[model samples]
Target: MTWNFMCLILSLFLSQFVHSLNNNTTDSLDTCLQDFAFRTLIRHRPHTGNLYNAMLPANLSGMSVSIVRLRSRRLWNRGANFCNFHIPSRTIPVPHVKRLALVYHDFGNWSSHYYTVPGYSMITPVIGFKVFDASNMMSRSVKKLSLNTMGKPIVIRFSNSTLSDGMVSKARCAIFSSNGTLHLGEITLANVCFSQDQGHFSIVVPLKRKRGQWKLWAIGIVLGIGGFILIGYVVIASVKVLKAKKIQVMEKQADEDLVLDTIWVGRSKMPSATVTRTQPTLEDGGLP
Candidate 1:
């Protein structure tokens, strides 16, 4: 039990340490990805309505990035749909520009490490997009833009989810807004999410039985088993003590009743003979 308590404390301490370290490290992840996206854009002559795949460095092998150049009028009229995101027809850039580039990315396996929904488990990859002004393609400093959905909501669809597997009833949409705030909402469609603005999006299932809180579950189990072992040891020690006391009491009684042989004659006591008789002593005037 004592050991288990120590282990639980240690786990909590390490959890905090790792969490703090993660926050520090992930703060630069977006900035680094943005630089790479811009490089990809300038490397190629991005044409309107054409989506081009961007390459990632070897260190980030499992991730993906894509960009689509579009005219603001076309976006307001027909909207833009690519890489699982659907911008509605009425949507327009908040600070309107003549042309814009929408950059899409998927964090692949690094999804959970960069973004997390505290009590839920992420089932699919983290995917999102950023809107950027592309008035001058050769320019270095392009301003980030936001969407005005114009009363219509943007939608994100996941191809990896199955609504028939009972996930539809349990899953909720998690939106990580541009300002790094979490917004959760119910999905009207089984495998879809709606949003007025952009950041990151994923579907998460509730941790009803602690499916996502593996650390807590592990600690509880360890403590429970350790307590059981401690109780067993106490019971065994108590039984051993009771038996030892009983044996001691029986030996004491036996010792008290134990007696050596003795002979009594005419109220005069004499030492008892053992295995041989003592020679009779006779009174004599002299040695005879």
Candidate 2:
């Protein structure tokens, strides 16, 4: 038992390590993508608001990144909308920077490598955006920022998302936030999700039940109930049979315990008891 308990502890630790390792890998990937996005912004400072695609190395081929710069006031009045992300008006960056760069990323075919919602399968590629301070592009230091949506949510739309059989009814919005937390919410529209902050988001459906499994389950339940009822009836019948046999044994014992005279009835012998309560008294009792 001690050995088994120790093994369980070890397994738990390993599972936690694996979970953290995935998050760590995604974190590193995000750092790399941010660097690439910042470099793209620096290379194209002339066009402040145009979405410029960042050229990634062959190692990250399927993934795409883009960046767009906007002033703080413009973001408050006309929120930036590009790369499948919609930031509505009245949104502003936290810590209040004069300008911010919105970096967009489409994880493309590699969406499952860095993130997964357990018991769910991804139906669309993971797409996300991050905000960073771009107020002083000349300076080397850059910091990340957060968005306050003011109760109005940011929309992430999955275009041309095709839900296969058995997934249409179960599909839901999965948001893996940047802060190491996950959230699941209902799918708004056909294939869309809303978030109040920056995060990687996707559409996921619960794992499907195996074919014909429910039939087996139903059969097992029916058999269990039937077996229980059969056992109950057998027990009741056995008890009644035993009671009848006991009553016969008691009658036999009573017949054996008493001595009786036998009389011939019409065609059967009947047990009859005959006894004198008092004998003839002697002269000592004379006349009573």
Candidate 3:
């Protein structure tokens, strides 16, 4: 009877332990599902259409973006009319996003969802005119131009859902402070040139470049190359001087040895009686 009671207690304890393990496993699975659901919602969700309501998700961080490339409307342009993303007002809208990437495929189409994650701002829309056609090569030619009387550098954020997936080949953005003329950091364009199969991507974050910047870069290169050559010349000249000094020392040593040798031969060949007779005594007592 006592043995039976002990067995019953042991069984109950084992059952409790198994139940606890099952509960833990179920909790872990639930947490994973919740995270997956959040990510999915972000990727598939659309931005609310309003110019004033630009925002980022509460879980994500925000950053500033700049115009790397700008496009303008022109005659025979094949790209779609400027795809406008209305920034909302009052509340900042968080953009639903997964990743930040630029992709290209064989299909001849531009992707509207160029930026991923939070934060989009369009300080100025594309303006101006350039004559171009809508072909593969021409598709790459239309560039964005400045918007509004070159007004105070516009600083604003853009939300996703500004355009459709296939309409936009590439997108660029820029930010400026209230003062129109003063510039901030280098502007960066998310998409530079989009090709059907591939595209030209910038290795560095694109910075705003003025027309004069090219000339400055050219001058810098020339100076750098010239400086490098000058340093090389100095090093070579130093080495040559060192080598000449070494040779001169060696020659001097040789001359001294030869003189010693001649003196020694003279001493050895002198007659034995006359060899030591000329030894000087106390400087020959010249001063005293």
Candidate 4:
């Protein structure tokens, strides 16, 4: 009876461990699928009005999957838009993704929807379906594509096939702000080659200047001007002071010279009168 009880207890522990492992696996797989969906949406920006059906293998139909539109205001574009999907979930309007994608999945479909995330400088939106089937499991892994915009504008240029074939094809261009908030739509390109081999595509996204940056520039200019004025005033005042000192010294020297000339003239008259009296005494010699 003792041996039987020990065996039963061991079996129960093993069973619990196995059950926990299965649950962990399922959770990890679900997280991977969500990441795959996000990456797919960002890479091939599809029109927002369309639907995307995930293509899964025959065995994974039981997985529950759904795409939820998460919105929040944060540092990106100063809380004017919500484009970042990787922000922490603790913030208000919590992010739908709880963690970064540790695994990569690829969807075979190429079409997707694009909606503009607000507060960007251009018409930039997180591209994904408004709704998806979360009721079933994903059979195959989704491919991971590069979708990074570190507060930088993405430039997408579309060229016609004829232009690539070395023919004169008319192409149109548009500009968006770095945050993808505003869209400067449908600009006509001049001198564009429509050749089939010479496709011309260029995206000129304008950089956004922050309000604080403008304020800093204005402050620097004002300080620079003020400093220059102050330095000029100091120099001018010094020059005037030096000139006044020089003039004062010159006037003092001139007065001293005038006083010396008057004393020399008075001494010369006294010497002449003394010489006349001595000559008369010598000529008389009366006592001799």
Candidate 5:
């Protein structure tokens, strides 16, 4: 009966342990799934007075969105300002978009006719936009648009234009966007364009899905390799120490043998004296 009770108790403990382990594994998987479902949103605080906003298209809803701030350009003169915004190859959640657009509000006080050609009556400030995908070796150019002080926003939508993996979008004017969740109809350009003076801008990026778990896995692999190397080094060092101790023990034994040999040689070299005087005294006494 006692043995049966002990076996039952052991089985119960093992079952509880296994149940706890399974629960822990389920919790870990849930955590990973949660992290994978949502992309981290970055907030951009504009330095200039011009307001910048990003939002999803009115039609699409319930989708994860993230906005990344790209490099901005500052316009200094009437001459064309050329700048390139490259989507980093290592960006997590690869950006994939079917449609892209640039929207800007005219905020500059300068008239479009400020820079006039010699023969023409007026010349407008022309903005050119281009998208380049180096991997595919293809470049798409947007028609040059002239900007005027209309106190209203302008939307330049790219129809059937898609940004592939690792593409660069280049613009020839001052534009910017705030960091936010990228959604459909989400214009990434600044609310207002600075035709004159210094201005800041960012590109709107639409990402496919969260892919940050790969980075975590890569880190874990590196740490595991380092641990294995450390363990190997400790094992090698232990082996070397053990060999050195064995050699020391052998050397000690050799030294002891040499000392014993030296003592034996000394004892063998000692001379032995005879008792001839004692024998002659005893014979003389017996004769008397």
Candidate 6:
């Protein structure tokens, strides 16, 4: 009796295990079908990719984004392309990002369909071309170069302009304790653009700011102005002093001339003048 019961129980256990495996397999298949259906619906929509791509820039952090293709059957034109990347703020400040995005809206004409999608537009690229042939496009090379390059923030720039010329590209971030609370400061970003381009493309290359250069320039300007002002003041003061000395000398000469004229007049009024006049009157009477 004990052997029969154990055998029956063992058979029931095996049956249950097989049934469970079947159910699990069915569930997985259902999930896969659902995914396929959803992706198909997205594919059939008109300009749906464009709308999604437009919204990408708002959601981006430290990565390069581009639109590669639109709706089409070709592998290249079927889906949106995204490049996943994360950069440490301290490693690259103000990244000079040059990553390009492309969109092949239709595969019917492969060459004609190669459209360089705008920054605001959404695109889908061939699954294989998501990174756009990294090997040929130097993707790995750029990535390695960026990783090896040192990045920083707090850059100062100097220019011929009276004001500083340094640009504050992206910043590296750090957390500091303030009043026992964590305070987040500037996080240097590798998304900076240095090109004279009018668009707001993120840059990936790091550049250092010119520091302490402003002080030197300011000091130079101040000294130059001060020297010019001092020289002008001295010249004015000297001119005033020389004019006063000349006026004093002229006054002294005038006083000396007046004294000499008075002395000559006094001699002419002396007693000898009165005797000469009396002698002249006597001679006139005798001759008469």
Model 1: per-residue Cα lDDT over 106-139, one tens digit each? 9888677678898998887889998989888767
Give the winner by TM-score.
Answer: 1
| lDDT by residue for model 6 (1-288), tens | 353344345434433443343334423322222222233333544233342221111112221223332222222222222332222223321222332222111111121122122221111221111111111232222121111114222221111112111422333211111112222233232322121111111111133567999999999999999999999999999999999999999999887765322223544742222223444445557632
| Residue clash pairs of candidate 1 | none
User: Where does model 6 exceed 4 Å of error?
Assistant: 1-202, 205-208, 261-288
List per-prediction Cα lDDT, in the order shown. 0.78, 0.82, 0.29, 0.33, 0.31, 0.30
Of 5 and 6, which scores higher on TM-score? 6
Q: Per-residue CA lDDT of candidate 2, range 88-107, in tens?
A: 99998999999899999998
**Against the true structure, candidate 4 has what lDDT?**
0.33
Clashes of 1: 0
TM-score of each: 0.67, 0.66, 0.24, 0.24, 0.23, 0.26
Error of 3 at 259 (Å): 1.4
What stretches of model 2 exceed 4 Å from their correct place?
Answer: 1-20, 164-169, 213-288
Q: Against the true structure, candidate 1 has what lDDT?
A: 0.78
Best by lDDT: 2
What TM-score should be assigned to candidate 3?
0.24
> Cα deviation in Å at residue 244, candidate 1?
12
- Regarding TM-score, does 1 or 2 come out ahead? 1
By summed lDDT, which 10 consecutive residues of candidate 4 come out lowest? Answer: 191-200
- Reference-based TM-score, model 4: 0.24
> Model 5 lDDT vs. the true structure?
0.31
